[model samples]
Target: MLLQTIFYVAIAAEAMTAALAAGRRKMDWFGVCVLACVTALGGGTMRDTVLGHYPLTWVEDPYLLLICCAAALITIGLARFMEHLRWPFLLLDALGLVVFTILGCDVALEMGQSPIIVIVAGMITGIAGGIMRDVLCNDVPLVFSSELYATVSIVTGVIYFFGLQFGFPGEAVIIAAALIGFALRVAAIVWKLEMPKFVYDKELR
Candidate 1:
């Protein structure tokens, strides 16, 4: 039940982010809906495909599809207001990353995957959607360059795995992992924290 709640919240958050991206691009309603669905469900779809989990969630649950479309439409109506509140959407995106990471870890662990695979799965689930979103929007994916985006997902997975290994209650582990991941993301934004970039200069080479 807790997982379901988190999953829905994550989807909604992702859909809103997608909608905002679409708005920036001045896409039509159909385009907005398409991007919203891709951003909201693309990560889980990739995870399930890799894990051989059949019948994708959106396919099996049409309501989730409806939710994404509805979210996009709502965002369209409030695009002007949302333009001034980008920080809230950024926070929501951070929350979505944690939720997706934990859910992916849970799924991989259930499948008896190794620690490494579980962590990788979590990262994939957390970032794939955003990757697709940026690709469609003609922008570099945030995961590839943004402050601690993918790092937060990996850390969340690690926290969840170790918390369970240490025998923490499941609910406690979930809350702890989410809070820690969200804090790291918020700190990254506030402090301008980032991983060092590798640059290639043709002249130097």
Candidate 2:
């Protein structure tokens, strides 16, 4: 039940993020909905496909698709209000990232996947949607350039795995991992923490 609730929250947050991106691009309502769905569901779809899980979540539960569409529509109506709530949205996005990471890790664990596969699945579930969103919007991917975004997911997955291996209660593991991951992400955003960028100096060559 807790996992399901977090999953829904994650999708809503991701959908809103996508809607905001669409608004920036001045897309039509239909385009906004399409992008929102892609942002909310694309990652899970990709993860399930790679894991050979049949019947994707959105496919099996059409209500989730409706939720994404509704979120986009609501975002359209609240564009100005949303613009003023950037910090809130950033926090929500951080929460969503943690939830997505937990969900991905849990799924892989249930499937008896190897440690590496579990870590990769967590990353895919956490970042694939944003990658697709950025590509569609013709912008640099947040995971590629943002402060410790993808790294947060990978670390969170590792933490969750170790927590389970060490016999932590399932609920405790989820809550602790989510809180830690969200905190790291929020701190990165607040403190402007980032990985060093590599700039190629062609002139030197």
Evaluate all candidate structures by whole-model CA lDDT and list the values in order: 0.91, 0.91
What's the lDDT for candidate 2? 0.91
lDDT of 2 by residue, 54-91 (tens): 78878889999999999999999898898688998898
lDDT of 1 by residue, 46-70 (tens): 9989988768767888899999999
Winning model by TM-score: 2
Error of 1 at 31 (Å): 0.9
Alpha carbon deviation, residue 18, candidate 2 (Å): 0.6
In candidate 2, which residue pairs clash? none
Listed per candidate, the RMSD to the true structure in angstroms reads: 1.4, 1.2
Model 2, residue 100: displacement in angstroms? 0.5
